[model samples]
Target chain A: MLVVNTEFVPGFEVTKVLGLVQGNTIRAKHVGRDIAAGLKNLVGGELKGYTELLTEARRQAIERMISQAEQLGADAVVNVRFTTSAVTAGAAELYAYGTAVTLAGGA
Target chain B: MDGDAATFNFLILLVPIVLIVLGAGVGGLTARTHLRSLERREAELTSIEVNNLKFVRDPGSAADTRMVLGQVVIATDYFKSLATALRNLVGGEMRAAEGLMNRARREALVRMLEDARSMNADEVWNVRFGFSNISQMRGKQGAMQVEVFAWGTAVRRGASA
Candidate 1:
């Protein structure tokens, strides 16, 4: 599927609007990663483990959104957006949402 | 026993002072180095244009288009955290925390641009940023860190255009 974060995809027109599709996931940092992040904080630098954790969560959220779009027979997902919230001290929720639409040309 | 107690008291006093000094020296160096690198990379990647506009005018026959993402998590050193803590008492701006956030944002943006460059895209559109504070514990302000995520649609122009 063609996914773009813009309202309209270039070279294609939307023929059918399938409304909004969304996916979300909440993940908590494990003890090992948390400990690593704590030490890294002392010297103040990028937390690679946390970055990977978020990347994985975001990818899963987007994948879930895409699957939902596929269920709606969408040719593309447009105007996609992501948001994050700290559900708890060590856990975060990642949400991906977008409009699913059928384009004039198939992906 | 008295001497041991006295020595213990002195050690307690010395630890914080040592930590603050180490934080200042190392953390300051890290931030400076990172800023320099950001400047150099930004100059190198000036060829690719990026914007937040939802739509592109005359996209020049787009060959390919897709979403790109960049993410980063950054934390403040002990010195900044202490500085912020003290600033909280005075109710003033936390310049140290501000610098940390700025660096994280720029790093995320630069990474997004690099992702676009890898795709051989000429322009990025509809850029958006997402952020969240992670690592704080319940009922306590633990290590302070911020996560910045930058995303956009990368467009590569067709040969015809």
Candidate 2:
């Protein structure tokens, strides 16, 4: 499925609006990784553990979003956006939302 | 007793001077190096056109659309930490920390542009950034940090629309 953050797709035209579809996930690393991150803080650099955690969460959220779009028979999802919240000290919530639409000519 | 007191006073005077010199030296060097690298990389990406405009004027045949993302996380240096400590007392703006955030945003954008350029995309639009911190300030879970993430769509414009 075609997915973009723009209001409209360049190649395809939107035929039918399927309203808003959303997906979200919350995730956290284990205590071992948190301990490693605490050590990494001393040197000052990228916290790889947290990065991976967020990336994975985003991926899962997007997958679920896409599945929802598919159920709505959307050919593309436009104006996609991602948001994140620190639900707690360790866990984070990532949400993906977009407008699902059917292409005019059908891709 | 006199000699020991004098020695103690001398050591007390030397410590902060040493810290200031260290902070300035390291902070200056890091800023210089980062600026040089940012300039070099920016020059290399001069050809890749990036904009936040939603529409492109010369959109070619609708080629393809794909998501591109760039992210960077920066931690405070000794100088910034020291400055922050001072700022906390006076409660004014923290220039040191602000500079790091600026650098992170620019660096993240550059990386995102590079990614789009590598994908053979002529332009990217509707760019957005996400800023967050990890497990910082969770009572020893981690040190403080700032993360900048840039995301956008790389579109291959149609040759003739």
Candidate 3:
């Protein structure tokens, strides 16, 4: 599948339009890391704990998006974008979405 | 000049230095943690690198491509942020975790895009991302995990065999 940030692929062409497709996920890490972070904050530099937190969260969200595309029988996605929001006091949410379509060769 | 006066003056200076070190350490740690978290999250999204291409035989229908993208991209980003925020608190030498995650996202996206291209798809249409967090949130046996996904339609342009 030819995927590009632009709506059109210079060398490739679109052939069909599939219905709307999307993916979403909700995640909450254990609070232990947070407390550790708070304490670590007192000493300051890099909070190693939160680094792990963000890494894990990003993985989960991306996984869900891929699964959704698979269900739609999409070979590729283009112009992918990411967004985030605060769901609760301690929890946050990440989401990804894009267009799904079929393509033809330039030749 | 008195001995007592000298001791008192020394103690006052010592107190400020100690407080400053403690304050600086804490501030630095907190900032690092927050920055690391953001980077780690970006890495996570990069880990999968979901790519979607949508296209049709008729160029006139190109408008629909944008329409679908409007929803798909927003949703994907939303879910990606959600996952990152959920894991925002995880700490301990986990700084720069985003570097790894970003790599993963890119790898995944490239692989999927290559697969689509091999299928002779000119583009992908109606592309969107989906996310799921199957990890348990409560209880001693619970685990935390986030999955990010990117999806789209592969199409042939101007009618193909």
Candidate 4:
């Protein structure tokens, strides 16, 4: 399925609005990564471990959102948006949402 | 016992002072270096058009379009965290924290542009950013960190609509 953050795809017209589909996941950093992060904080730089964790979490969230769209018979997802929240000190929640729609000619 | 207590107190004061000094020296260098690198890369990638507009005015025969994402997590050094803590009491703008967040955002966007470049895309549209604080807390010691996620649709110009 096609996914774009814009309201409409460049060359295609949206035929049906399948309402809103969303997915979210909460992930916690492991102890090993946290210790490494604490040390990295001293000098200040990119936390590769945390970055990868977030990327993985975001991918999972998007995957779930896409699966939901597929279930709705959507050819594409439009106007996609992502949000994140710190559920606690060590865990964060990533949420992806979009309007699922069917294109005129379909995907 | 009295002499030992005095030395213990002296050591306690010296530890944080040393930490702040290290943080200032190293962390400052890291931020400056990253900023300079970002500037250089941004200048180099000036050819790629990037914008938040939902639609491109002239796609010029869109060849292909796909979603691209870039993310980064940056942590603040002890010095900045100390500055923030002090600024909290004054109830003023925390410039140190602001700089940290700015660096993270720029880094994420730059990475996204690089991703588009790799795909041989000319422009990126509908760009959006997401941010979060992923600092782990440990009692009174919590490292300050910010995560920036940038995403957009990369369009490759071709002979097709």
Best by DockQ: 1
RMSD of each: 1.7, 4.1, 13.5, 2.4
Q: Which ten residues in a row have the lowest lDDT in candidate 2 chain A?
A: A37-46
Q: Is the docking of candidate 1 incorrect, acceptable, medium or high quality?
A: medium
Candidate 3: C-alpha lDDT: 0.46
Which of 3 and 4 is ahead in lDDT? 4
- Total clashing residue pairs per candidate? 0, 6, 121, 0
Best-matching candidate per TM-score:
1
The whole-model C-alpha lDDT of candidate 4 against the native structure comes to 0.86
Off by over 4 Å in 1: B137-139
Q: What is the descending DockQ order?
A: 1, 4, 2, 3
- TM-scores for candidates 1 onward, in order: 0.95, 0.80, 0.42, 0.91
lDDT, candidate 3, A1-107, per-residue tens:
43443455444566765544455565565678656544443333333454455445655665666666667776555555566554654565766566766677544
- The number of the candidate with the highest lDDT is 1
The models' CA-based lDDT, in order, is 0.88, 0.74, 0.46, 0.86
For model 4, give the interface RMSD.
Answer: 2.7
lDDT of 3 by residue, B82-119 (tens): 33445566744433335324433433344345555555
The better-scoring model by DockQ among 1 and 2 is: 1
Poorest 10 consecutive residues of model 3 chain B by lDDT? B67-76
Per-residue lDDT value at B127 in model 1: 95
Please write out the lDDT profile of model 4 over residues B1-161, one tens digit for every residue: 99999999999999999999999999999999999999999998889999999886564466667788889999999888888888888998889988998999999999999988998988999899888767643223456888999999888887544
The local lDDT score (0 to 100) that residue A79 gets in candidate 2 is 87
True-vs-predicted CA distance for residue A21, candidate 2, Å: 1.4
